[model samples]
Target: MFIRGGNMRILFVFIASILMALGGLPQQTESAKILATLSMPGRSQYIFVENYLKALAARGHQVTVINPFKNNKATPNMRFIEATKVQEYAQEMLTEMDGSNMWQEFNGYTRLMEKINSCTLDDEAVQQLLKSGETFDVVLAEMIEAPPLYGLAQHFNATLVGFSSYGTDFRIDRIMGNISPVSYNPMIIAPRTDRMSFSERLTNHYEYLLEQVHRELVHLPAMERQYKKYFPRAQKTMDEVLDSFALVLLGQHFSVSYPRPYMPNMIEVGGLHIAHKPQPLPEDIKEFIEGAQHGVIYFSMGSNVKSKDLPQETRDTLLRTFGKLKQRVLWKFEDDQLPGKPANVLIKKWYPQPDILAHSNVKIFITHGGLLSTIESLYFGKPVLGLPVLYDQHNVERARRIGFGLGLDLHQLKQEELEAAIHKLLSEPSYAKASSQISERYRDQPQPSLERAIWWTEYIIRHQGAPHLRAASRDLNYIQLHSLDTLFVLVGVPLLIVGLLLKLSCRLLRGSKPKSCPFADKQKKQ
Candidate 1:
């Protein structure tokens, strides 16, 4: 009886193995073609692009990436396409102009548009892409501003997917819909009372108008001229063509952002940065983190800002503040030397930010409030002390006010204030609690962000550009797109029509009763 039972178990194992083999458990085909463009190199943007491409290749797809790097450096299973030489004219124009504040942003935009307009459609990058031996099923463009690649995607008649490095701001949606490309950060969670504030509303209104003017008066004309020059054979207007078929994959998670209405194609795919397995910290950094006694505070201004650019007085104030703090400080300063070294402070040009945040000894992150930094702190369940410098940093820091984090203006930094903010964060535990709650929400998402991005990219290819997801802006006219004017016209028109009719009716009644028509007089006599 025991032998018979053993024989039955063996049979069950054999059958299960056979079933697994027959099911074709790989679950994906090996030869599907995908083309991805990474317009920037050696930046966080490239990192996100590389990961997504790797994910696709792992899923049995043939992936080719177009990287702008000229040094022939790239990962396995990826190809690099050298971008065209930037025009000297554009460069000189940008240099001669003083770009300060919002005007600087516009100057950058103009230069970019000029470059796009000047680029030849048959440039080496575009030719190599078209002539590449493999037939691509789909093309994904990294940013809204990558004109040559966006043009190439059109030329190849492949499905176009837009990957935004920022969150799903309404302005990006407008660009995809051919409405207007305004700048906004959807990651900021504005409180109801704050949104209603007169100052806030006024700022919003001014931004909206400024965006519209920039798009209609400044950007669109240049885009149209470029479209005509590069894609003359194309039938549709630049506006219509851009809006025809596209999807926006934002690098943000819904959990951390404010609740707002989003279209189906505008997907939230944050935490793609954290999707990969964490790398082990180097021995020196590991030892420093392990040896901390009163906990550690991580400070970084992110990649774009140079710590050396900070004024000497500001740097001295920061160093002094760190000296007073009981916690050990890790400052990501580019320079090795400080005027006075704090006993507990360690200065490194760069730090393995994620690994350090994961450490138990780390207590708070002092940041420039860049979106990625803020999100990373939230991902690791650590609170932030934001020092906003430029661009959307203001929006990011303000948004964090919804939670337990604190924001400090970079322009208002004083030794006492910095010390006070740092001390408060160390003593209070609620900030960490709030951050962890957000982290839990992020973890509870249905699937990892990279997986969602890959699935959507492939799904669009499978369904022939996913036309069903495209938004229809044809129903929207000039007045409708700008609706405040439409409301005034709708109300004003009815009142005018009623007044005109009343006057006409009164004139007819008076004419019939007394003087004007002979027929009216004859009828009255009868």
Candidate 2:
């Protein structure tokens, strides 16, 4: 139906008004092209990052994931590039790991970081991707140890987002410009808690200073060399690349992790990896779990640390202890054969951990206290017995502090101690109560972690890196950030003023005639 000229003008104005009103409301964002790199070796690490990437894809974003462990089946809106050399290196390093020696663990991990950076950079597929002229709206990479990977954001001319599988550490705090006060914020490797004694605080400060020096002098220099070699035409240096990160999705929830300060750009997506609906347990494992008249105690040493690597004596102690427990034991043992395996205990090379924990009959988790495993336990509302062998002590220690679990040194574990702790976790109602309370608090978020992560990622994309969220401290140096220069001015100025006043008074007193000195005159009269 054709309208009259006057009526057409009226209709156009009415349509324009409706369009203006619609524009005032929130609009749907454009689907983003996201390049996510998870270079870390552990399958556990892969799980967290993979879940996040899948969530982005589910939101209709195009995501390309580069990692050592690639999924066999590709989902819609997602592509996977396998870094095979990295996979081999990780397997070799993790297989030969000796978790009892802290120095060895540190050194091995340091070497692994070097390998991850070099291998990922040198991978044929990654090299192909580099030269393909592909563009990404955002480049998300695990920020734990691979500083060189930060260059990818610059390479793709994309917004930088850091994904921390290890949660917040001195390195993460440094990169994100979060103020980590040594007095209260203990380093991840530090054995001390947030509440520290004078000596502990000193130790914490020393640890921070030492790691800072090592990162600057040793680790980052090597990464810088790699960055220069790989992306020679890149504008920013490695250090600048580190500072350019728009957001960090941290694997920590304040409900479980240490209560510390975080910048606006630093987000906590603690249990993002946990499936909303966990998979069903295999039939045999299901029967074993269900048949336990008493509850089941699930044991695992996480992905990196193999249970079969335990010392024979330690394995024997574990076996003997499990034999005493009335509850059924499901252990993630790499080896198929346990010579003296208990009738009540079932051993497998792997188990669907989150699924196992989700079962109502699973009461206590005996874990290596890795962050992901602990977070899973918390998600499932189960108490844990942490056998922490290395850096994982921090995770277990926090659990102990929060009364969700107890930790024991894996190298120094005793059968009696193991048995007793297991009994304590099973018998004590408070531990279960704490686990339940913390789990409720953890689950009580404005939205689920995955949704929050996707929203933030897209937020950065919509705002073109969201530079406003970045901390201003990123632009400051050591003295400026700590305000040492200002502090010196504040303290030294007052001190110098007092010193000058004292000097001036002394000069006046010395130069004045004896008669003009009232105090001197009084003293003489007396």
Candidate 3:
């Protein structure tokens, strides 16, 4: 009986290894087809492109990437369309986030869009591809940054797939018919908690309305101009072109983000970035982490926010706060030298972030609350202390309220406040416990997220855009969607009855009014 059980276990392991090698999707039978992609909003977004595009290529799809980053090296089945020397927009955006002037932030943001448009329009690679006779089975683009790139799909007569770096924004929500209720659900970019007070709800509603108005009044017009500038020959309107997207691959799922009512055309492929096994940490880092008597704390502001760029006071406060802690600290500081360094803390310019979080001795993460880092901390069951800089980061507050972590304001940062927040996280057992439980649920899927992503991608190709998955709301206008047309009729019909009754009663009170009426007059004549 023992031998049989051992054999069974070995067989199970063998089959799992085979699946892992094939990237965990079903065995491919279809011949390779062309799948072009454009997702160069930032370095981190490009990281996602490197992940799934390679997997798609491995599954026998020919992949062509139009990105600013050079990470996706060409192969027999893969190619690159280099957008000439585009700066990483995330760094500039972070700078704007730290600024006081709202207009400055807005201008910085507008500048980013212009750069993206200019890069594609002027790039020798993109220009050649746009004018070439090449075709692709599909064209995937980043929904947030590059809506104009949808023209690539239309130009090639290929299916359109939108790749969302994080959760759905208001525009994507309206398209997919998955807009969450602001009464209970927070806005996509707003950092409000789920359970809101009356004032909070009112604020959320106002923000949602403002976002819609801005897109209609400001953003969409600019996008339409770009769309026309790029693909002048295409006949479809901008809204029509957007709705034509066959599927949207979003960074959301049950454990990492709040529940959303998604339509069939929307696919949640959260944690696809971290689906693979992490490489081992450097020997020095391994030794430092393993040698700590107490657990270690990992600090990173993600890829874009250099620790050196932080104000001197902010850096000094963090150093002092970490110095006071017994636990060892490892910071993803981009500089080789941080003067007045603490003995308890270590610094590195870059890190295998996921691998470090996987270590048992790592206690918590102090992060910028960037979506990828936020998901990884939760994915690995490590408690977090979020110092959010910008964009969808306010959702970090939800993590604190749910007992997985705590948050602090970066602009208001001080040594004592930083010290206290760390202390609270370390002392609280509930945070760690909650994180662990959630991690278990997050990994408890039937198939890996990468496999799921690959399957859906292939599914769309096989079915020629998967048209049945589109939601009815895609065809609905605001009045029809809200049933305002029905409401007006309901209200108007009742008012009409009441109005006629009032007129008839007034005629009766005036005496002999029925005889003067047209029907009464006709009956009298007969």
Candidate 4:
């Protein structure tokens, strides 16, 4: 059925014309080879990142994950390079991270940053990444640990995506540039409520400013050292590389998290780890939960904090309080066994967390207020009691405010305080009601978070770096961004005019009086 030579020429021209007309449409490409790096050693955080990459791989992308966890069952499209030492160090540090005081917390922050930089610098996987000669279409590096990791994008000659599983990153916020005011956006460490008082808002604002100062003075300088060591051949400065990130996959949704203005380059995929259907719990735990005539209480401090590390008095206080409860307690106790066990409480080293939360018998949740836990508890519509010890004070505080829960300081665990909070949440119906409302709002997303993430990731590849998505604020300087200089002119111009008019008036008055000056003196003398 071959066409004649004249006819073939006409057919080619017709097809070429159609392609030219549709040139304005998106240019979709083949699956990308994505290098996704998630090196912060928290397992929950790892799960969130891994889940997204899994979705991408399922969609036919060639995904290589640089991680701290050991290899799990692998897939044809997925590969893992684990940093074992970095993994072990992070676990050890987080176990003791709930510091006793301000100095310890500040010191802990610095030491952890130092360890991350040093450990990652010596990480064998990182060395391999630099020398492997393997290329990627995109480099998605975790931004929570260190800024130097962003330089990996320059090394790969790929689009940089700053991934912060911590939900919010002030650094990335500044990088992508949005119209975020300091007044409402509290720092991760500030324990402000959803409804801030005038003084509280001021405190949050000042604390945010102080944190920015610390990042500039203490944090960035240390990260810059690693950046220099990593990508020495780059023509641009490290600051330039940091500023040029093509996308930021933030683990925050404006609906669940505080509403803030975001740029196109910043994509929020808040609940990527939440499975559509929760996996089933173990046989014994399932039976126990089913047998509970009274409701159940589930407690976990997440993977980082171990129950044994708690002070003896604190452990005693918790045990004594739980012993009297009528409801069944499912505790994620790390120990093989609790020495003084309570009849009402069941001890398991671990349980299928989401599954337990989904159970009808469960009435309340007690957690360390890891962001993942906070979000999941709400998703399941259970009132929470937050004992926030490490990392984000704001997460637990926010949970306490919105999730109909009470927050307690990890360092100051009193027996009465623990008992009262537990009793109140269990007996009161308002907490559960509040939790259900938030859950309804959260589940009302137009699409699941994972779909949005995958779409944006592929969007970056389709457009070959989507530079148009960048916020206009990224190009602005401090004076221009805040319009401080413009404000000065607005206030100063009127004052300047008044000053000039006043001077002219005084000069004219003096000139009018000058003619009588000599005669006035003579008359006075006579």
Candidate 5:
């Protein structure tokens, strides 16, 4: 109780050291639980889920992937939640519609939308998974279609992160108050000078409005009624849940996308699924690439398009053009045989695209202009000869106009024109230079896209939800966001006054003022 001054100071120093040590101790890393939902079993989806889960798991986190697939043989660290059969949906729809033109395509899409809209999160299998008592910090749902995933997020009181596989327009519109549902076809959605006219724009808007009305009034209400029939206790409406949710993680790059205003939470994490390490090329493919004296031309129609589906006329034209090119060609075709032998062209069913693009000998890429392919071409600093088949290809081409002048439409494609474009891309240095400039911009990203995505996801979890990142667009009316109301107030009000004064002057002598009341005279005297 009775201590000397020197001893008291020493005791204080000892206490302070202990407190400092305690304060500087490393914070305990919490085990984060995430539920990742991929609607279908596809290479792209698989890669994205796998990489994201791996990244999370590597950082001492737990990931559970829920998909239509039952095969859980891939990664050991993560858990899998198998849903009831849904692959049959796609198979049946594809069979029913077949590959048809735009009108038929719309009909097919409508049918599929109806089918997906029927699914509920409270199904027996879904409930069984929930019974395990596993709680998640966040629900990462793929933007396949509007589903009960948002409801699940609400039920768990967890953050909802939308993993968008498409471009910004439709998804951005969905996040905002715009209820118009536009069909996403790169070929059509991507604005083209030759294809999209003023009338077409009006038609697109009308179509979107009709689709939204159908979904909200007819489709979603019916689904909710059906879900209530299955689960009597489910109280939330699908529309309320979807509209209330914020944060859209888009799988798109600004370099490949057209200029548009976006919400703060609308992040462009394009190429997140791209493999970091290059896969080895087969011996024959290696030899073929090596054999080219000038350079190699790589041609692929992306993941969806099968080369066998190409029309005979188109195939023949492509082959003939390849025959004339001085550089060797690598064609990714499913078929083994060709009509005529082109000495320089090598045909293969598959090619390691990223690896080939990274190759020094690869001078040009002839692509169908899928977003991923276009971005990769830009990432590798190579000029693209786009033969856009469908979906956002037109948009990609339009965006590319600012930099590389290498995009060509499939409709305008001919042997002569194809040859001319290819020759120009190869011979002209500007295309390559422009492409490289884009690649530099892409390479100079603040961080790797996947890391940025992971950081944001974790940050959301830590903060209970990063509401600050959500864009003001969600709360703003169209007029307010675009300043249309302000413009009208400033310009229209002045113009209206001038017009009224002119009309009044016309009715009286030119220099005469309009009759004033006693109130005006009183105010002037005051």
Candidate 6:
């Protein structure tokens, strides 16, 4: 009672420390052993998971990643199991995937996923890792096309954490027991804004149904084959693996993407792949960008889509259009030579995309509408003119909906149209204003996406899978999830009661009346 103020403060600190150590207060979990796999094809997909795993490793976790895309640079606390064979199959299948044809694209991806899984299991490095008798705290895997990788979690008796490079779709929504209303939540295959017209909602609902049928009839069967082939002795079945995800981190945000519902276990960590600040550009590129008398226009088709693959006519149109522009153009062309390259244009095999977008001289981005590219453009506050091809529709549609960009049909593109679109983006102040507003909202988070992703990941490990965050709806069947059975009772019971009342009234009338009506009987007697 007579202790000095300093002594009392020390005593309070001592008590708090004891409480924390004794588990009365929260404390950091010990380092974890993480087994992660990324079987998705694109470099963009790999970037999201790679950055996340790096963060986990930096936080004292030991990570082993099995991916086709290998980081040559060696780093401590992380090991790479390069499954290079996955790439061969992925590329071949990607070429066959026609984004315009729904069934064709679905079948193509289904076959591709099967081959990718088989190749992953067949890889010597992966085989050795699996047989190494290694145990892990968690297995982080891409949720989209790599369900077979879930077996690794079962093998190691670890929780499975799903990592998606895009927002949740119908398949993911169903698995996670999240509500994705068709009226507003657009299907991945059918792109639309949240505010849809009547026709758009109808189409969205139809597409959603078709997606569900495809998942059951086509996608699930393909996944089941891969699961059984690799993990025949797995403790849980394929259905169980689909349902047991501890949590999923989605690289989507409402700032650019449409607002949608998510479960407690579904975390939005959009833009985690984007650097907090752009990295330095190479000397040549920096000079080209800075030396632009007018602002520079940056064009890229992302990693999977090569600019060199464009038809000769389209290429000519682009060159001819760029030739007329006052601005300098920087294009990410895969080929070494551009036959008709414009004097105002610079072609490189690759450019540091985010760094290029970050430059003050950059005016607008002409992109293929890949999710990562869309996010990067918004992050840098640059208006876009998107030439969405294949799976690029959704991202481009979002850009158009947000008023920061415009989309052109790649198939129907003409020189006049291309020039007009580019000029519109540059001349319209509203486009730049919208881009800046969205960029501010996108960056206005309490913490960075990378940090949020890492903390949630660690939280799962600390809380032993965090089962409490999981939705109860995961246990419900389709009929139950939608309350269809409840609806049947609600409607059928009222109808049944009315039918019974009608029957009773008929019976009462029949019993109270004579064989003939009273008046008719009287008339007959008279």
| TM values, all candidates | 0.79, 0.88, 0.87, 0.87, 0.73, 0.92
Which portions of model 6 show Cα errors greater than 4 Å? 1-26, 99-101, 512-526
Model 2 misplaced regions, further than 4 Å: 1-26, 91-109, 512-526
Model 2 pairs in collision: none
Give candidate 3's whole-model lDDT.
0.78
Per-model lDDT: 0.68, 0.85, 0.78, 0.79, 0.68, 0.86
Tens-place lDDT per residue, model 1, 1-526, is 3568889999999999999898965344335676776643224666555677777777777777665445455455555555544433433433433466444566566665565435434457656655664467777777655454466566666677778766755556665554422223321323222234566666655656665577677766776777677777764556655565467688877677655556677778876777456688899887887898888999988765667667888888888899888788888988878668798888888888888888888999998777777778888888889887645465445546656477776766888888888887778888888888988887887778888887777767666777787666534666677786878888888989987775567568665343444544566789
Clashing pairs in 1: 252-270
**How many backbone clashes can be found in candidate 3?**
1
- What digit string (tens of lDDT, one per residue) describes model 4 on residues 175-225? 778666666766677787546889988887777777677678776787787
Q: How much RMSD separates candidate 3 from the native structure? A: 7.1
User: Model 6, range 1-526, lDDT digits (tens) per residue?
Assistant: 5999999999999999997879865457799999988776667888776678888888799998888886789978999888887676655777767656677678877887788788888899888887888899999988875678888888889999998887788778777888787888887755588889999999888877776778789988889988998887888988888888998999899888867778988889988888888788999999988999899999998888788988888899999999999999999999899997989999999888888999999999999898888899999999999998777897788788879999998878899999899999999999999999999999999999998888899899989999999888999987998899999999999999997776566557666554444444666799
Off by over 4 Å in 1: 1-30, 40-42, 68-74, 82-104, 112-135, 146-148, 176-196, 227-237, 335-343, 474-526
Locate the minimum summed-lDDT window of 10 residues in model 2. 95-104
The weakest ten consecutive residues by lDDT in model 4 span: 512-521
lDDT at 105, model 3: 47
lDDT of 2 by residue, 431-517 (tens): 999999999988888888888888888888889888888788888898998899999999999999997776567559866565555
Please state the error at residue 95 of candidate 3 in Å.
Answer: 4.6
Better of 4 and 6 by TM-score: 6
lDDT of 4 at 5: 98
> Quick one: best TM-score, which candidate?
6
lDDT of 2 at 424: 89
